[model samples]
Target chain A: MPTRIFGDIPGIPEGSEFESRVMLSHYGVHRPLQAGISGSQLEGADSIVLSGGYEDDEDLGDEIIYTGHGGRSLDTGQQVTDQQLARQNLALALNCQRGLPVRVIRGYNHRSPFSPTEGYRYDGLYRIDSYWRERGRSGFYVWRFRLVKLVTVGAPNQVDEERQTYGETRRVDVTIQRIVRNTEIALHVKELYEYQCQVCRTLVFTSAGPYAEAAHIQPLGRPHNGPDTLTNLLCLCPNHHVMFDFGGFGIANDMGLIGLDGQLHQKANHRIDRQFLAYHREHFLMNP
Target chain B: MPTRIFGDIPGIPEGSEFESRVMLSHYGVHRPLQAGISGSQLEGADSIVLSGGYEDDEDLGDEIIYTGHGGRSLDTGQQVTDQQLARQNLALALNCQRGLPVRVIRGYNHRSPFSPTEGYRYDGLYRIDSYWRERGRSGFYVWRFRLVKLVTVGAPNQVDEERQTYGETRRVDVTIQRIVRNTEIALHVKELYEYQCQVCRTLVFTSAGPYAEAAHIQPLGRPHNGPDTLTNLLCLCPNHHVMFDFGGFGIANDMGLIGLDGQLHQKANHRIDRQFLAYHREHFLMNP
Candidate 1:
């Protein structure tokens, strides 16, 4: 007795019997491809054989069997004969479960008629009839298959691992840079001038930004020994930075503020006025 | 003869006369609070004064002297006396100078004032004439004078140095706390799970904040070994944190996800999926 199978029905385990019921609900849905043995050609022969797989019928075979290149006499094996060719044709049709519109195309560079020449095209296509027939002669049968399912999931299929690794590594690198910058600036300021301002008592941040500007006591443009050195730099606010830059002020021999015109007086009256000087005298670096 | 003594200003050693002029101009325009002198009494004194070794003025003894205690008497100190005070008062009236309001209440804090009692009623005021008359015959007088001037302008009296210092110190402390918190959290995450996630290949951040969150693999309220061990903690984002907290999704013995129904599936299909498991398989620590 030949077993029966439904090509459209999913091959689920016995425990998942509900799957067949669900699939049957969509049975009327048209499928262009069909796979099964054909019964018409092999009439009135002793033990008539159907090469293709069985499908809801006992007289047909469960799979197709390839009889090789046809259109030749089987008894003589010399010339292509009509009867031998007919048998081969029957075998191909039964094995492939013919009567389906699905077609298989193959080539190294095949272009679809509807697609652009530069775009991708189907390189090979094998109808269900031919596929089953080819597999039957190779001693293979009952190939299990499942429908392709789509899902909108996080992370793309390609390069997801690489992206994740790169993101993680980049995050760590950024964090380390912040820490190193903070510590390096602090240590540099501490080492130079012993962490003290020459004209103000502010000693909070040593970073190179708005709060603390690494000032050049001697002009950067001027020829000096260590313009970039911490010793030549004084951390100052914008106002004092301008004053010092324009020679409106200077540190006295005793490290006091000497006003413009070479006066040690708080005459210019900039932000670093006398009161600030007093603070500096009490707190700034004594030898800077 | 009036004598003159000139000393270079504290910071301006060259005596920068222009600086003195600038200081005078600043005092005239900005009107900084007078230091080291009572303002209301001496309206005509220069920015600086010369002390003649405690000797009294001898130029105008005949003028009247007003005492702080609501009394008036003849000037008896040598050639100069109340006449100088009268001249200064006349100069104030003539718009050459202005006198500050006399603070009659002594030791009465301006910020927090105390009610006056009988004993301290005239605390800040006293009579110089009566003080002298009470001690001797008539009144003694001597003669000596000199000239000096202000050289530097300082901050207004409103600038509270102590309060500013306190504020700066507070800001520094807060910054340090933030830095320390960031470092501690980062280090904690690095140590836990040995710097890898059991479900994803994300690395711990060196800085704090949104980089990492502590996760309990089993759960907090469970009776298992959820007592804050490095093994129990898995650093994750807010999304992953919530998913692992409420959803019954967990890593199986092979580090693959075991869904809520205890089904061990390498392929994730549910909402709380284990898509990040592939990276973790290669990077994360596996016990078995």
Candidate 2:
């Protein structure tokens, strides 16, 4: 009855009840129930739940939100109502209209320490975009949904049905030419840093207002053809444009800031060209 | 007659005449006409042609390739004929039905060397999925078409009409949970590396045949909780999985082959747990 086992196990000969699974098998799916503390609760679980909590996943930045689930009560902290079963899988992830597939079960959230050590994982495919019925951070009565993430984007000669159902063999279609930047020179260098963040000055408001990120410093397509000028841009703010595209830091030539810590202040009036800060310290900080 | 200019441009005392443009101003565009050495003719000009030549540049790619311009017959070596605006932009890029957008102008053929430094710089939209006529390499007959990159996919409460006409603001909406594997343990470790590439053994084939890439060597999410077993996988081939996930190399604790140079060679039948290659040489080669 060898149900499924593979590779090196030299010592399992002693007990032999045939229990070598390792991971990925959560069998029949469907688990959602928790409550309290939701939006962005990483270590304590919930993972994500926006909108119905009245928006605040960084104010729904990056769009799509309207997410909610469960009416937890675990005995007297009562508020569990709206017809459960994870609200019928949020009405079957909102009528599966070409999207529905998610996972992350973990011992049904006991205020989450993710102890699922085994039994639920897949985590992809989502698409419900909208649902309603809220009011329950214990005050009981929840059920929001808006989902998103079904991400299928393939048609360039199509062939990515989940990487061909995960058998994913070398695909290669290649043809990436590039050269873009002329939205009036990226909105005149993000209004000359007025949108903020010339190095953690952090601004980011939003609702259609302040929000930075222009960054470029020696990066404008294939093998650094860097030249979109304003001395190769950089207003930043998406966490310092992913920490200056992950070189973690750089900027000196007396303009100071060599690997983070500060003092490259000019605040604005345009004058950055120290040969593009020595080409971002010779291609991303002395070659990262 | 002020024509689109933005922000700070002080000073010009030494240049009494005035000329500070910096880029972008190709007015009333529509200039595609050339010939000669076409395909693969990189640095001699022709920037791109793959068949019928005409005139249409609808701000480059994302859904539009009904392109066709003029043919060049530069002093003798001739074949330029198929007229009528390249047969009505190849019957509107083979009948719109849901496609179009392209760009690659460079001194209109005549043996390439990409010199479209300006007067054309959007280049990023294509979709002609298929077209035919063949006979070229100059003996002229050309009409090919095949182009692909159209990519659109949005719809979860929409908003990505080409990144809102390219004004792309950091849109996040993420919910990407992972952990999918177990297609019978990735097909028994690609039949125990029989699919090839234990460090450049290569084996790629295609048309639905041989193709490797199992990789893993301790890497299963969250600070590498790694454990999908089969001695922690590795079949490789996407250029050695980007050189073994960019630490450029690993696998020595006497199983040999540390920073690249071959031989852990077992060929099959299991047994490779040198403590998961010493946890890929202590978490990605001595902490990278």
Candidate 3:
């Protein structure tokens, strides 16, 4: 049941602290141990913690505000009634109507120097930017929200879930041009493989960096065009650049590891150009 | 240093069991705790257990003999000297001169009913087949070896290790004839995706069976020769069949998940042929 993760969790970072809330539910940042919201009115909200627990929250180090859970009164912290929007408050109003972001964290309390003087911190992705209902200081009503801070990384409006298959599902889109190489030659072969994976040398990391990819070795476009040079790149690790462009494995003029199981770590000043590994074993191996 | 595995470790099986040897080193199975051998002499002996710590070992369910560690005597099991051929006994004589295999396990003692009435069990993959050096009954000069028990899976003498890649490395081998298809229509679309992965339902397993991989949505050879029909297969799982034959992602006509990040999950009576997803978005999505 942990699958809710909206913005950044991979390799966590932002102010990062944690010591409890069961270590922010073991690094999912804020996974409700006593419920300061975590998610679900059906999959909407994906995190939250803030911990000034509502006398109208308002953290302000990168804007927060928060509140929304239930009537209050954990033994006279007062309020006692009117607070329902329903489950994780309609899951943070469906991450403010689906622009999604969430995460946040903060916690500790001594009255907000942006909180955390003892435990939870995380402070990273936000964007709920609006929500309301009001009336507080114990006269009831409650709800609130607000949010903000999500510095940079804006494009791709978040959506990534692959792993699909089902034959004959009519999918169709076909516009073609191809040869799109030199993004600084795939970031110079992914910083010459420090981003790893020349076939399983692995190196994932992610809150957006250290990932690895490059790949191409022959065929840059239509009918085996094969070349956008740097001897046709290779870095790999997006599952070995889609298993070396979909023909699962092959590479052996002494840099061994022919294919399938894994472990070919080589590094010596890279050198791949054996005619693009003989055009990937003549157009991708079919059992030999 | 563990990473010596040879025939089968993925999803362990053969009699399985383990309660300690530190729970068989947290399931890389027999990874030495009180050391009854577990690889290295530059990667050789990958695992062994055998309960009777060598009184001229024997066991014999499908054949055994074993022994070879050091010359005995923790007190009076005697022969405390002359036993070297070097660590893990030249790693079980380099798995009896490289026919590789190894793993074994057993360890329970009452002197064998095929052992294991208690702690370890595993009993699978053996093959050392012969070693020698002899002289003991507690007299000294030991070593023995022999083994056996592998059972079937004959061919593929086991090499498998792709992930080696060095630029300019002279790799070559091009014999292309292609068109192989029909292994029962990719095992009937991998048992209609019960072998899961239609995008990422994932199914892994691997004691040798449940792994997925049918792929093909188009290109079956050369200039996209396409066809071998079933509206061009898909099953996937080897990293989504190399990111849908390396375009990485593209299946929208209502199935969404276009080019990367991933989470597609669809299922129904498979039907896929939209001109093979429009020939994989015009020969592998070059963005847009």
**Each candidate's DockQ score against the native complex?**
0.01, 0.02, 0.01
Q: Report the C-alpha lDDT of model 1 over A144-166, residue by residue, as the tens digit.
A: 11101111122221111111122
For residues B20-70, could you state the per-residue lDDT of candidate 1 as single tens digits?
223523423112232312222322222221112122322121111122111
Better of 2 and 3 by TM-score: 2
| lDDT of each residue in B145-253, candidate 3, tens digit only | 7676643321222111111110111121100001112434665777776878877685654211244667677655323456766667877666556445534466766
Query: Which CAPRI tier for candidate 1?
Result: incorrect
Error of 2 at A209 (Å): 16
For candidate 2, write residues B171-232 as lDDT tens digits. Answer: 21111001112323544677677777776575643212344556677665322356767878
lDDT winner between 1 and 2, please give it: 2
Flag regions of model 3 displaced more than 4 Å.
A1-105, A109-189, A193-234, A238-268, A271-288, B1-106, B110-190, B193-234, B238-288
Task: Compare the candidates by TM-score and give the number of the best one.
Answer: 2
Q: TM-score of chain A for each candidate?
A: 0.22, 0.31, 0.23
Give candidate 2's iRMS in Å, 1 decimal.
Answer: 19.1
Worst ten in a row by lDDT for model 1 chain B: B126-135
lDDT of 2 at B185: 58
Q: Name the runs in model 2 displaced over 4 angstroms.
A: A1-66, A69-72, A75-145, A150-196, A199-202, A205-216, A225-235, A238-252, A256-276, A280-288, B1-148, B152-288
Better of 1 and 3 by DockQ: 3
Please write out the lDDT profile of model 3 over residues A78-104, one tens digit for every residue. Answer: 788977667887678656543466777
